[model samples]
Target: MIHQYQLNGYNIVLDVNSGSVHCVDDLAYDIIALYQTTEKQQIINKMLVKYAAVPEINKAEIIEVLDDLAGLKKTEKLFTPDIYQSKAFDFKNRSTMIKALCLHVAHTCNLNCQYCFASQGKYHGERACMSFEVGKQALDFLVANSGEMTNLEVDFFGGEPLMNWNVVKQIVGYGRKIQKEHQKNFRFTLTTNGMLIDDEVIEFANNEMHNVVLSLDGRKKVHDHFRKTFDGSGSYDLVVPKFQKFVKMRGDKNYYVRGTFTHNNTDFTNDILHMADLGFNELSMEPVVCAPDDPYALQEEDLPQLYGQYELLAQEMIKRNKSGKGFTFYHYMIDLEAGPCIYKRISGCGSGTEYLAVTPWGELYPCHQFVGDPKYSMGDVWQGVTNTELQTQFKLCNAYARADCQGCWARLYCSGGCAANAFHATGSIKGTYEYGCKLFLKRIECAIMVKVAEATLDSTATE
Candidate 1:
C-alpha cells in the first residue's frame, strides 16, 4: 500500500512491500521503524498536516508524538498499502512488470487429457502443430523485438510439447543465440505431460532450461481417470514412472513437478499434500474446463463449492508453508514466495503487453486458447504479431478483459484472473469469477492480518 508521511522537512512516501520511499517527489530513504523523534518528528508532523491533508486527530497525535518519539507519528493521510494500491496501475515506480514470455511451441499434443484446457484432443479444422520452421521464425521475432529485456524468460507450452521436440530444441537453441547476441541472461521452462520427456530431453533441458513444469493432477486413480492415451488406457502410470525417472536424473535440484487441479479431482487440501508427498515442491492449479466433449460438469450452482475448495486449498498450503516444509503455489506463486511480482501492470497472462503468440501457421494470437477461436487470430505465420481485435480484447476489452475484477482492489494483484479462463468459464470477460476473485482477496487479507499481527507483537516486545 502507498502511504504518505511528513517528518522534519520531508514528505515521506513508501511502497510498504519493497520499502521504496519518496520525499518531496524525489527518492527518500526507507524507514522500517518510525518512533524515534531524533529532532525530525515535529517538522514531519506539521508537514503531514500541511501537505498531506492528514486528519486533525491523527495530526494532533502526530504532533504530540513528534516531540517525544524519533520515528513515530500517526498521520492519517500517509500513504499505506491500500492507498498506494488504489493507484497501482498508474503508479509510475511500481516494480511489477512482465519479466518472461510464455511461448506455445506446438498446438498439438500426443495424448488427449480430459481436463486439458487447450481442447487439444479434437482434430478440428486448422488445428495443427507448429512446424520446426515456424517455431524458429517465432523465436527470431521474439528475440528481434526484445529491445530492453535484460533477463528474458522463455516458457514453452503445448498439447504435449514433446510431440514437437524439434520445436522445443530450436527455441532453446535460438534462445541461447539471442542471449549471446543481446548480452542478456535468459531462462527456459517447459510445461509438459511427461510422456516423451526421456533421457535425451532431460539432458538438454537440464543443460539449457532452468525449470520444467510437469503436470500431475492427483494420485494415480484421479489422474488416470482424466488423462489417458489413445487406446483409453490411463496415462497416470505412464506419467508416474516417467516422473520418477525424470526426478532421478542425477541432479540434486528437482524442478520438474507441477500440479494442476480440476473440479473432478476433489480433496483440494489432500491434493496439495499429495503433491508434496510425491516429492514435488510446487504446484499450479485451476478449475477444470470442460468443453462440449467433457463428460462431467457443474450445474452452475457448483461454482461456490469450487470457490470454497480453493479457499480450503489455500489454507492448507499456508499451513504447509508454515510447517517448515518447502511448498509453492502457482497462481500467486511469485508474489507470495518471490520478492513481490516483478512483472507490472496486472499479471499479463498472455494479454498482449510484452509478447503474444503466433499460431502454427504463424498467425498472431492472444494465447493458445484462441488457436480454435479464429476471430482472435491476427495474421498467418507469414505475418508478424499483428495487433488484432483479439489482441485488443487481450488488453483493452476492459468489460470482458477486466470486468468485476476492476471493482476489486486486488484486480492488479491477480491480473484480473486469467483472461482466457474468464472468457471460457464466464462466457465473457464481463463475467465475474465471484469465487476465484473473492478467494484471492481473502488470501490477500490474510497477508494483511499476518503483517498487522506481527507489528502488534513487535510493539509489545519493544515495550
Candidate 2:
C-alpha cells in the first residue's frame, strides 16, 4: 500500500508495507496515483496529457520515472499486497482477560491548574474520594477477571491520587495480601501532582509502587504559568525540592518527571533542558489536548513551532548520548527498531480489551481520560464489564475501521490514534482530529529523522 502527501513544498510518498519513504515530483506523484487503478499504458497516456502544456514535460523522462517505480514494485518495495487487512483480529474472539487497570483513588486535588483536564480533580462531578471498601472490591474485580494472567498492573490515578493517601495505601496492602492466594502479582503505579508528596508518601510509593509519575511542567516559569495553586501562585518552588528529594530517595527505581506543553510554550525544549539541569534523568513532556478555543490549547499555528521543538529535542538527545550522559526522553525513545508491524498495530493498547479504568465509585471506563464521562462507562467493578457491545466496538475500532488511517503510513505506529482524543474531538472513537493528525505525522517524521541521524553516527564511528 502507498500513502502520498505534500509537506513543506515536497511531494512525499510512503510505502506502508515496506516502510520506505520517497520524495517525488508532481509528475511522479500523479503517475503513482493513476497507477493504483489504471493500466500502465493508460497511466502513462494520462500523465502525458496532464503535463502536455508544460515545457518540462518530456516523454522520455516520464517513462524513465515510470520504469523506476515499476522496478521498485517488482522488488516488492512499492505496491506491496495488503497482507495486514486479511490478518485483522476478530475482537469478539478475543479473550475476556483484564491485564491492567487505572484506579481513580482521589476525586479532588490540591492545585487548581488552569488547563487541568480533570476539572481540578472533581472530574466535572461532585468531589469525593474512593473508600477503602470500593478500593478493595476493585482489586477483587481485577483478580477475578484476570483470566489466568499472572502479572497484572494497577495505576493509582486521580485529580491527585495523593489526596486520598489512606485508601491508596490500603489498596496496595490489600493487593499484596491477595497476591499469594490468587497466584497473581500486582505491579502498582502512582501519578501525582507533587503537592501532597510528603516523606511518608514518597517512602510508601518507592516501597510499594513499581513506578511513579511526578507532574511538573518543565521550567519554573513555564510550569508555574499553567500548573499553579488555587491562589494563582507558582508551584515550582513547592514541588521541585520534593521531586528532587524523592528521586534521590527512590534511587534506581522506575519513575518519570512528567510535564505538559501548551500553546503558550511551543518552544518547550528549554523546559526539558531545565528538567535535565535539575537532575531528572527520566522525562516525559506531552502536548496538552484541550478545546481549540481555549487560550492555552495548541492550535494549527503552534504546530510548526512544536515540530521545530521536537527536532531541537532530538538533536539534544543525540548530543547527550554522544557525551556519555544520555537520558530517556519518552517521545524520543520510540522503538522503531523493534516496533509493532501492521498486524499487531490493528488493535491499540487494548483500552477496553486488556485494560480498564475504575473510578472512585467503582465505575469502569476504557482509560483515565474517560473516567468522568458517563457515555464511555463500560461496566462497574461488581458487574465486570457488563457492556460487551461497547467493548466490541472499541476492539473492532482499528486502522481498518478508519478511512483516513487506511492511507496513512503512520497508522501502525499510532494504532489509529487515541480513542479518548477521538471521542473528545469528534464525539466518536472512530474519529480523529485534524490538528492532532498533523501533529502526529510531524512527530513520526521527526522520529524517523532522529533514528536516521543516530544510525548514521553509529556507522561513521564504526568506519
The candidate maximizing lDDT is 2
RMSD of 1: 9.4
How many clashes show up in model 2?
A: 0
lDDT string for model 2 (77-113, tens) is 7887766764555642375788899998988888988
Q: Which one wins on TM-score?
A: 2
TM-score of each: 0.70, 0.84
Those runs of model 1 whose alpha carbons end farther than 4 Å from true positions after fitting are 1-102, 121-127, 248-256, 291-295, 298-324, 332-338, 341-350, 380-382, 388-403, 425-431, 442-463
Each prediction's whole-model lDDT (CA): 0.57, 0.83
lDDT of 1: 0.57
lDDT tens digits, residue span 373-401, model 1: 76666654456545445444444433214
